[model samples]
Target: MYQLAPNIELLFTEAGPDAADRVRAAAAAGFDAVEMWGTSDKDVASLAGALQETGVSLTSLLAEPRTNFTLPGTDLGPFFTGLDRAVENAGLLGCPRVVLGSGIGFPGAKRPQNLARLVEVFTEAVERTRGSGVRLVLEPVNTRVDHPGALLDRTADAVLVAREVGSDSFGLLYDLYHSITEGEDPAAELANAAGLVDYVQIADAPGRGEPGSGAIDWAERLSVLRASGYDGPIGLEYFPTTPSVESLAHIKAVARDA
Candidate 1:
């Protein structure tokens, strides 16, 4: 079975105030792994200690400062600074992946032009993290619901950039919620994204909540991802209508079956 990693940032709030406490909460919820947004501002030492105490592996985190990737002549200094911190902190937590977003679309810029810049940025990032064992993943967020004007909302665009960048340390994150929210069928999209995805994130559509609360057939989704031969940890990055534990009841079984 593919390993499950709970997003402690959005899920597992029952664990309480401190992020380390949330790590413990995820462990208690029966997940052997946990993920977060960025570890830069958090207590990495304490979080590391909790992971050691609970034996939960840190799977992934966001590329800090949420660097945007759409403009041609935009300054990348701030983004790389944040990336450096993200790498150091992720190494401390023993995480191997960091998520990046394709900021907003550039005004008066062609898609190809922006994508070229995106590839260049990720290429440099890939070089920076080379030998550190950390992989950079570009994620596509939905525009209609959560993120309007988001440059790379389609999974295919992420696939394009990842392919153009062409590095083992860089790939796309196939987010099921965003795909469904965009009205694209996962079964069809997964076929094209089969080899390009470095990680998987899922929340149901409509409310971005638990699997059973929305319209996605997770069993079919997971089965399709499996057929794509993706065996990485699937991040359950969702909001729960009830307690986090209660939310997992439906998808946990689906994951087990997957």
Candidate 2:
């Protein structure tokens, strides 16, 4: 069975706003792992304490104040600074990965040129976070629905960037929801991106809701994922149509069979 990490930002909000309490709620729900977006707004001390007390692992968190490498003359100092802070917080929370994004590309630049620039920026980002015991995973968000105009939308493109970056510390975050929303075939994409995906997240397509609430065949998809050789924790990053626990029933059962 694949270990599932529910995203606290979207799941378990029934526990209230304090992320620390959410950690507790996720634990009570029998989750041993959780993920979140940014840490800046959270009570780090309490969150860390909750994780320690509950023995729940933080799978990953976002690299904040995302830098748009495609934007000409964009200052990268803040991005690196934010990365450093993120690494520090990850250390505190025992998080293993930091998710990075290629913000909207420069309007006037060619796609190849923008992607090349990403290679340079992420190369340095890997170096900057070296020895932190934190792996960097670049995510390709869908532009069509959730993230309009996002520079990196295709899983193939993200795999290319991760390949170009050429660091063991850097890899790809294959979000099944985004890939499906962007109209790519999961089996084909996962096949091409095999061995490079360090993390995976999921939500049902057509509405980005919990698994059974949408059209995806979880058993088939999970089988394809396993076939791709990614035996890692899958982050449950979907919005629930019902209570969080109730929303998980389908995927949890499907995953167990998968």
Query: Where's the lowest-lDDT run of ten residues in candidate 2?
Result: 66-75
For residues 1-258, what per-residue lDDT tens digits would candidate 1 score against the true structure?
A: 879888888888876868899988888888899888987679889999999999999988987677454445576777888888888888898888888888875567788887777888889999988888898899998999999888888888888888888888888888989998998888777888777888899998889998999878889889988888899998988888988889888988988899
Cα shift from native, residue 50, model 1 (Å): 0.6
- Which residue pairs in model 1 clash with each other? none
TM-score of decoy 1: 0.95
Candidate No. with top TM-score? 2
Would you estimate the TM-scores of all the predictions?
0.95, 0.97
Hey, what RMSD does candidate 2 come out at?
1.2
- Mind giving the per-residue lDDT tens digits that candidate 2 earns over 224-255? 99888988999999989999999999989998
Displacement of residue 242 (Cα, Å) in model 2 is 0.3
